[model samples]
Structures are given as structure tokens and as C-alpha cells.
Target: MTASPSSAYPYRLRLPGPITIPERIRQATARSIVNHRGPEMRVILEEIQQWIKPLFGTTAPVLTFGSSGTGVMEASLANVLAPGEKVLALVHGQFGERYAQIARALGAEVDVIESEWGWTPDPAVIAAKLDKNDYRALVAVHNESSTGAVTDLAAIGALLRDRDTLLLVDSVSGLGGLELRQDEWGVDIIVTGSQKALMCPPGLGFASVSEKARKVIERDDRCARFYLDMRKALAVVDKHETAFTCPVSLLFGVHEALTMIHEEGLPQVFARHKRLSDAMRAGCVALGLPAFGDQATASHTVVVASVPEPLTGGAIVKHMYETYNTAIAGARNKLTGRVIRIGTMGLISEADVLTDLYFLERSLTALGHAVPTPGCGVAAAVASLS
Candidate 1:
């Protein structure tokens, strides 16, 4: 299924920003599908896995699955954790809360360290919890997309270095968009999806497992879910492949995307995301909207902003879509109707930033909401970047 540029809303400003498929990926997919278990496919899978390791800053094997980000989340729990094991689950937003639910459903004893939706959990608090508990694993969402907050994985890793706790991280939105040092941070299992900063369509899930986690899983005799077993997945990886049918299209896209990322240089890619995020936040602040996440814990991909009392987030979104032809994400759950999320990852540019700010101001004014001026947001963004 090729995406047509013309099919996109002509005048609509895409707030979520669209996925970018490089020419190489298109050509790769154009090749006839081969047997996934064959040697040729095995070589491709190995190369993809090798390419993914550096992106996660880990030398460990990265397991690829034909599933969504949630699949990896489920796999992490089912494979490494046995029923009745104790886990420290940190909850700062919707994604973090998911770990708590998944862990509980797996019959694990879950101890949660809850923080406000828009704030990050203090590393000290995480350390305190680890100090008192003999938990089997510590689970955290490195970047909470729902709240646009980034947890300090390095600090959390430091806290767990002295302990026997396995650090499991959900970095679905954090991996390629920000600076993530998985091996350096001592993360045991790190998970990510293709749809975020990887610049690919959704459906591919990835996880890099540490040697320590591998040993623990190897020692456990419990049977994991057939489809989500990490041990079986690793066994296949040893043969340079997956246990089940993989999403060939998405894999093709990932392979191409990684090449594009390499060509651009990882440091430059990260800087681009950071610059776009800063521009978006500065634009919002200039328009009188407050950024939702704590400045210190802000993510480079998405920026959550509180809508003014008189101007609802929905109204802003609607105006941007109908009038300006721009799309933006709304708040999730408790934050619904209260916040607007602007994404700054994958194929976004300086022009996109300025255009978004311009339309945002116009949309607010058209909806009878207060905004500073026509170019105030753009000006503020420029000044912030300077």
C-alpha cells in the first residue's frame, strides 16, 4: 500500500506529521517477497538487527517482531517475568500506567511509584523504592508520550547499578528522537516502535535484551506465551531470524530508514528533533499556552501544552484542520480537552514549525481565543532557537 501525497488533506497542517518512506525502502519492498525462513531473509534480518543495536547504544541483540509497540511491552513481561515475581512499576503517565496493568495481569506483585501525569518521577524516589524492595525488575517509560515528559534513565540506571534489579524501559517514542544510551544506562530490556522517530509506518516492534536479563530468562522454567516468548525469539535470533511471520514491508521500511538516519548522522538527527521541540514550545509559550511537561523532563518528539481557559484544545485542533489544514494531537485520558500535543519528529522542518505557529495563532483568534499576534509565535520560536 503506497501512500499518495495527494490523498493527504491539501490545506490541512499535519500536526502528527506523516511517516516518510525513503526511495530505497520503496525499491526494497518492490522486490518479490521471499520465504522469511530462507537464508536471504536471514541475512537481511541480521543486518537490520546489527543496525538497530547502535541506535539503542547497545551491543546486545535486538529482537524484531511483526507487532506494535504494545507487543514488545507484553513480550518483555511474559518472557522475563514469571508469575508472582515482584516488580517496581513507575507511573508518571498513561504509558507508565500500562506497565502496572500488564505486570499485575501477569500475576506479578506490583509496587508503583506514582507521579503527577505531567511530571517525571524523581530519581531519588526511584532509588528509595529500589532500596527497600527485592523486586525482580524495575519498569519505566523513558519518554512518556501521553504527557511529553522524559524520565532520566541514566540517573535511574545509576540507582539500580548496585542492586540486582533488571531495568526495563519503554522507549517507543524516545529511542531515535532523543539521546538514549541503553548499555551505558545498564537497561536490561529496552523497547521501541517504528512509527515514531524511526520514520516508518507502525507495526514493527523491537527490543534489546541485556545479558543479565537473558540469563534470568534462561534459568526460569516457566512457559511464556507462545507468540511473545523472548527465549524463543532469541533462539531464532541466534539463527538470524524471527519465530513467526514478520512484517516484510515494515522491515523494508526500517532498513531504509536506518540508512537514511546513518547518512544524516545520529547526532544531527537528535539535534534536529531537539531544535524542532524547542521551536514548538517557544511558539506555544509566546501564544500564552503553557507547556505541560516539566522543562527539565520535556521530550524532543512531542510537546504537550495547556490550552487557555477560554480556548479549548479541540477548538484549536478543529480550526487548524478546517481552516489551516493542519493536524495536531489531543490530550489523552484525564488530560483530554485540556491539552494540545505538537509533535516534532520525523520529516518535520523549520518551515513546518513556523507554519504551525502561524496557523495556531490564527486559529485561536478565529475561535475567539486570545493570542498575542499573527507572527508572535514564529518570532518567539526564532528567538528561542537563536
Candidate 2:
């Protein structure tokens, strides 16, 4: 079982989504709801389009939804796949499997290139599969939150540069934190949520569609969908309106979040996530908790580390919450008692990373797991940051 947040009013949310929101963003959400189709809403929508495009690395239309990341994931597939259409899914972790499952549920004949939980799918292996099959599209996850493993989208994108097969990417935990050049990478569709590195709440999903994907969306009527229909969303967004009544207050928060992202500049945001991830990994290793995945391909958004023997991941997670009032994450599926996840995305700072490491070292010690040296974890993290 995971650590319960039942004891506190505001335990530091160190999860992939629903992360700690900054005061400006929280205040943005508290603003009164506006008319979803009014002039003010139009202006907000226009501004969001202007700001969010660079984050997706796309100049194409980026659609918004009144749903979570999964909704846009579904939308990306729905707009392109037809009944019994063959699709290739590169599965490394849970979220990658979820994307494939969504395709299967849509009646597509889903084929998967499965990799171990802690590793990402090899681009060469993916190329071999592409050579063997005439898939309608290839599905991939930009960052797998479950295992904290990041797939090399740029490499995968290069593999499909001249192919007819579309590349649909699930960038849920990656967009604002990692490097993504959607158009340059030749990705057809890119899906993400506002809750992750975007530093907003969980009610909004965004998708950037390339001209090729838009052409498929415009021509395909096989997948029956209403709320997730990209055609309708595209038509209205061009008018600076929504196809349906959007979550007005949540969009307000998203607007504020995007404003902040632009102000800091995307390069600096990516650099910050890199620094924090490096620090977290260094600190964990110093505490005898090495990273769970391959270091070369590990995620910079969420850091996954192994828990030493005789100490359960859940125990340390619970201890962190109960003892320090801070929340970390436990593993899923096969990794369940062995690993802990630390989120280093939006609104998280160096101080937060150091404090988390300090408390984590204490928690491990309190749970009867000995560290190499007292204060060494924080010291290693500080050194990494420098």
C-alpha cells in the first residue's frame, strides 16, 4: 500500500501529478469562473495558444480538453485509428501499456514491443518492428511515470521521418520538463496534461496536432467520439472558442501556469529539472539507494531509486509522510516493494530536493536502514547541484 495523505492538510505533494502548486497558480484557480464562450474566455484561449505552443515544440494547433492526460491520449488515438487498424505500441512501463490498451479498446489491432520495466524501448528494436509491420501508427510514451524512465523520442522520431506511419507521443510527464521538438521530430500528435510539469491542476489535457495528423483526423470517421473529437475541437479553437464548455477556472490556472513557464523561459525550466534530478540521484546513491533505471535513460522529471534490502519502499514513503509531512511515491506492479519515486517537476526547487533527501536519509535510518554517512546525502546532492 502507498502512503496515505489522511493525516495532513498539505503534505508536500511530490507525486507526478497534483504536485505542489505555487501561490500564483493556486490564486489563478480561485478566480471566479467566466463564460466559457465569452470574449474573456476567448482572450485567455488565445493567450494559452501563444504560450503553450513553444512548450510542445509545435507551431500547429494545440487542442485543450476538460479531462486529464489520459483523455488526450485517447483523443490522439481516436482521431487517427480506425477499426482493426494495426498499430505498434512501444511498451516500457505502465503508462505505455495504457496507451496500447486504449488503442485496443478502440478496436485497433495493437502490437507491442515490450521492454523491462526499468528500461526504455530501444530505437533499433522499434525500427526492426517497423520494418516487419505496416502499422497505421506507432505509439510511444515520452516519459513513463510508473518507472521513471524516459524514452528517447528524438531517436524514435528519426526512425519515422519518411514513413507513412504516424508517430503519436504521450508526453504527459515530459512536455514542460524535458526537450520536445514536436514538429522538427516529425511527431504527428503529442499529448500532455496540465497537472505535471505545467504546474497546474489535473482537470486539463492538451494535444498538439501536426498537419499530417489533422489530415487524418479530418478524413477518419471510423472511431466514434464526441468530447474527444479533434475536428470539433480544432474548428472551435480556431475561433478562440471551445467545442464544449471547458473547465473555466482550471483554464485560468493553466493560463497562469503557462505565463510563469514563459517568464522563466523553457530552456531554464529544463535545466532546473535536470539539476534537481541529478541532485536527487546523487543524494539517493550516497544514502545507498541507487537509481532504479538505467542512468542514461532515466527520467529527469521523476527520480526512481531502489530501497535497500529489509526496507520496503512503502515503509520509507509512509515514514517520509508521517515523520516529515512530505510525500514521496512507491512503485507499481512488479516494482512494488523495491523502489521509491521522487518527483522533481514543476514548482520543485533545490531546497525542496535537499530537504527531501535530508528527511529521506533520516527516515531510512529510523526504519533501521543504515546510511553510509550522516549528512552525506545532502552533501552529495549539494555537490551535484554545483
Candidate 3:
């Protein structure tokens, strides 16, 4: 059982994004593609509009784009930022840094306030920065996937409530799994992808826009834009149309995914994610791999742990994939080869978490790392799930 794909054709996707799609959602995606501008497509878009609102906790228009979450991140910046405008970015991990980069690329003078990897930025610190200087917007990641650290969006939003800065959040991996009251939190814009907690395949990006953000977008004409322009997207939102050609198959999958989520009920859906997160953290800690970030603010969507001494994250990831047909992800950039991330988002269940922990324990022991007990990790996971 070398690191080869011998019989791993249908192996589980335990990574953060591009999660294992449920059978029904896959079947929906396999259905024949429909015309993008047809009556059927219009109805699908209309239903999506209704289904996606509660996920973001917003009644504001959620503009969809035929791109990844990164595309919508760029769209959010391109729409509201004028050239040479000063923006403040709170950075903690890879995704947070990417948001800052997008702002800089859009010609905004971005001032980044960074925290150590695996930890979230403090809201008080953000408040201090905002009070000291005037920024056009404050950008942050609702969930830092690389470190499995979830930011306190509501707290951060409270700081900006009295300020003039717009609250732009990248909830690509957080929207469905975590609690996000976009409008209630005063979040000006929220960008998300279909792949993470939504249980759909990639290729669809969404942005929930508030009136304040819309006003900034409407006034900004400094950046060059065509397909990513929010004004054009908003204009046709009421008509159930997109400015560009839509990904009809992906939309079908999203519709099915949202239906499943709705059937489960939003509160239950969030509780499920919280339960999964608890189980994953317990299992990993029992295996001598404590969570990498602040446990108090750990993300419900993914669990990250630093690999133990005398073993590399790559070796563990490889062993799990090659020997057990399981797939987990390693940390990015600064923490590369140091930590492993296990996703608890989307359609993952208790059985799946237990199986993952069982194999993960095996992988650790096989890689010359000692496990405290033979079945302790799985046992702890069971206890947490119960």
C-alpha cells in the first residue's frame, strides 16, 4: 500500500473545500444542463435567492458569479474600492492575507494588522486601529481555513458600527457552517463559495451586499471592471438573471444542496457543524495532536492540529491517503509541513469522523509517532459525538 491510488477511486474528501458531495447533490449535478437565460434557469435562480438568504442572515441582494470564492472576494473589493483609497485588513492566516492582497491589487492602499498564524485578530486591536485612522473599509476573514481559527465577526462588526468603515468579510468557508448574521452584524459585504459547508461543487461564488456597500459601489468608478461589476449583477438580480453566463449544472447542484440544508433546518445544520467540530477536536487531542489555534474560537468547519515531534505533517497526510484511502490537508505557507487540517464541514457525519480518527491514529502510529492508547482517539470522538 504505497502512496498510490490503487482502489481509492471513491476516497473521501476530508479537505476544507470541495467536500464530499452527497449522493443526491451529485445526482442533481449530473442532470442535463439547462439554458442559462431560460424560464427554468430563472426559477432556479429565484429559488436560490430565497434559500441562500438565511445562510448569510441577510435579506440584502446576494449576487452570484460563475467563479470561485476568490472571484467574489475580488468583486467585493473592485466594486467598493476606489484607486488610492485607504483600507484596513486584519490578517491571521492565508485566506486573510489573500483578502488584503485583493484590496491592494484593486489599487487601495491597504494597511494590514496581522496576528500570529493559528490565532484570530483581536477585535479591540481592530477598534484601536479604526479609531486612530479613517479607512474606507475593514476587511477580514470570518473563518481562517488555513489555521482553523474562526473570527468573531459580530464583535468585529460592533467595533465598526459607529465608524464609517465598511465591514467586508470573506466567509467562503464559514457561511453555512458558522453563525453569521450579516445584516444584524452590520457586515457590509460577505463573499462565499458553494464548495465548503454548502455541500456543493465549486464554480459558484456568492456575495451578500448591504445598502451601505451598495452605495459605495455605486459611487466608485475608479477601478476597471466588466463581468465582476456589482452594479450590473444587482440590476438583473430582481429579474433572476446574471450579467454573464451562469453555471447551470453547478446551480442545479447548489439548489439540491440548499434543499437538503433547508430540510435539515438552519439551526440543526449549525448544531451539526458544532457537534462535528467538538468531535474532531476531541479525537485529535486524544491522539496527542492538540488543536493548533485558540480552542475557544476554533472554527466549526475545520479542525487543525500541529503534527507531533519526530513526525512531519506530510508523512501523516501521505499515510492516511495511501494506506487508508482517506484525504486530509496540510497547512499553507508559514505553517506548511507543520500542521494537518481535518474538515468537519458539509455532509460529514459522526461515522465519517470516527472512521477518519481511527485511520488517523493508525497513520500516526505507523509514522513512528506514539499514540497514547490504541482506540483512545476514536473513543474520545464517540464521547464527544454522544
Candidate 4:
């Protein structure tokens, strides 16, 4: 039987009430909606573009859409590759497969390098595939959420540096939470959403395009879908606006979130995320749970752990939520009922990690599963930090 949703504890740690709105932006947005094509709206649009560049580690114009990250993912393919153009895709988990699917749906020839779900794709494997095919682009996920794997972007970028292939990345879960340098890595197109590391409620999607990717968009023989067309987005953004009505509330939320990130400093924020991730992994190890991903390929945002046979991942998640009010992600696809995912991104803290450990241990015991001492996970996390 499935656990009841009402009995779920939501989250053990209280997240700050909906992101705090900056008084100035709130007051400005609270005024009646501005004309979408007016000069005043242009200023707001330009400010948003300028603000987004730094977060992405790029000086290029960043495009915004009032849609999910999937929108940008589709846009990246639609704008760059023509029908039947070849692409070498690297698949480490579900997101990678999604990229391949999107490219194929757009009529691009997709040559995929499939890796074990919980492991990073080997660069050598990708290089071998590239050697055989003259693909116009290569797609990879910076962070694989389903399997909790982190691909080495720098290595992958280096491999594609001299090739004509555009290095497209799905950084939805990695942006701001992990180290990503769009310019330095030679990435042609990078897509991210507002919810994860940006610490804003969902609704906004962002993409950073390189000169190479832009050129491909111009040269592609096939016309892109009007709404998902990147060329159109770029044209409007060049005038400091969007091709369609924007998500004003979410844009305001992004402005506030970006301000907070800048104030905290990007490097410091990255360090905090890394520290939290390391601590969470340590906590998992301390609890006698083996991490699902190979140690060398673990993602910073989510940690996947193998649960004992009788307990099941669902039961563990249910117990943690119902008994401790802590919400955690569960395994997906083939990993269902096998692994539990603990996400330590955005505003999560070390104290939250310790608390999760305490509850996880208690919940396991309550479920008639044996676990180590209460602070074992906490100590492991601290040791990893040290």
C-alpha cells in the first residue's frame, strides 16, 4: 500500500517563506502592468538580461522565457540543427535521454553514447564516437538528477574544442549549484531553470548561447517553430524585450534572487553548495548506506543511496516525511524501490543535513530496519568536510 500524502511531513527544515521580495521591485511591479513594447519595459528587460549574464558566467546575451527548462532544451536543438543534421549525444541518465529524444523529434540524427545510469560518461567513449561521426553538435547533462551523476564538463569541452560540433549542455540542476564556466568550457548552448540553484519559484527558463551556436542557428536550413525559435528570442532581446508576454512576477522573483546571489558572491555560494553536498554524502555513508553513484561521479545537488532490501526506498521516504516532516526524492525508472535521493541545493544548510540524518536513522529503526548510532551520519559528513 502507498503512504498517504496528508501524512507526509512536507519538510523537516522550514524553507524561508516564499522568497522575500525586494521592496523596490515589489513596489515597481505592483504598479499597473506596463506596456510590453514600451520604453519602460525595455529597461526592465535589459536589466534582467544584464543580471542573468553574471550568474551564467558569460557576457553573451542570456535569453529568458516564461516557460519550463524543457522549453529551452527544445529551443537549443530547434535553433541550431537543421532536419537530419547529426548529433553525438552522451547519456548518463534520464535527462540525457530526454535530450536525445528532443533532438530526434526535431529530425536530427542522434548518435548516443550510453553509460550506466549512476556513472559519468567516459570521455574516451565520447571521443571514439566523435571520431566516427561528423556530428554538428554534442549534447550532455551537466548534472544527471535521476542517477545523481556529475559529468566532467571541462574534459568534455576540451574534447570538442577543435571539432566543429557545438557543445550543448542541459545544466538545469547544475547551474549556480555547481561550478560551470560557459565561456571557459567552450560550451555553445547551456540551459537552466529558475527553481534549482537560482532559488526562485519555477516559471522562468534561461539559455546562454555562444557565437558558434548563434552561427548555426543562422545557417540551419530548417525553420524553427515560431514560439520556440531562438533566433526570434535573440532578435527581441537585442532590442531589450521578449518575443512574447513575459512572466512579470517570476521575473521580479528572479531579479530578487539574483541580487541575493550577487551579494553572497558566486564563489562563496558555490563553496557552500559543495560543502553541503559533501556533508550529505558523508551522512549517508555514516548511516551505513552505500551511495548509488560511483564516488568519483556524484552530483553536488542530489545524493542517491542504496536502501536495504526489505525497507524499500518508498517506505524510507514515507517514514522520513510522516515521522520527521522531511521531504526527500525517491528513485525513478529502474532504480525505483532501490535508492533514495537526498537533495542539498539552494538554501539548504549543514544543520538541515544533521537533522535529516537523525530522522533517517530514527525512521529506519521504526520501520524495523537496523541503523547505526544517531549521530553517525552527522559525524561522517563532518569528517568528509575536514
Give the lDDT of residue 277 in candidate 3: 88
Clashes of 3: 0
Sort order, TM-score high to low:
3, 2, 1, 4
Candidate 3 per-residue C-alpha lDDT over 1-386 given as tens digits, one digit per residue, 9 for 90 to 100: 55484384458789988799999999999999888999999999999999999999999999999999999999988888879989999999999899999998889998999999888888788888887888888999999999988888889889888877899999999999998899898999999999999989889999999998888888756478889999999999999999889999999999999999999999999999999989999999999998897888899999998887778888888888888778899965988888999899998889889988998998898888889989999999999988
Q: Which 10 successive residues of model 4 have the least lDDT summed?
A: 13-22
Candidate 1, after superposition: displacement of residue 180 in Å?
A: 1.3
Task: List all candidate RMSDs to the true structure.
Answer: 3.3, 1.7, 1.5, 3.2
Better of 2 and 3 by TM-score: 3
TM-score of predicted structure 4: 0.90
lDDT winner, 2 or 3: 3
Best candidate according to TM-score: 3
Model 2's alpha-carbon lDDT is: 0.90
Query: Which regions of candidate 1 fall more than 4 Å away from where they truly are?
Result: 1-31
| Whole-model lDDT per candidate | 0.83, 0.90, 0.90, 0.80
User: Per-residue lDDT of 1-386 in model 4, one digit per residue for the tens?
Assistant: 65544443443532211222334545544556667778867877787787778767788879988777888898888888888999888998888999999999999989889988898888898888888889888999998888889888889999989989999999888887787888888888999988777777667899999988888787648546788788788887889888888877667667766777777888898888888888887888778778887878787777788887787988888877666767676766778898888877777767777777777888778888766776687788778767
What are the per-residue Cα lDDT tens digits for candidate 2 across 299-365? 8899999987899999998888877788788977778989999899997888999989988999999
Candidate scoring better on TM-score of 1 and 2:
2
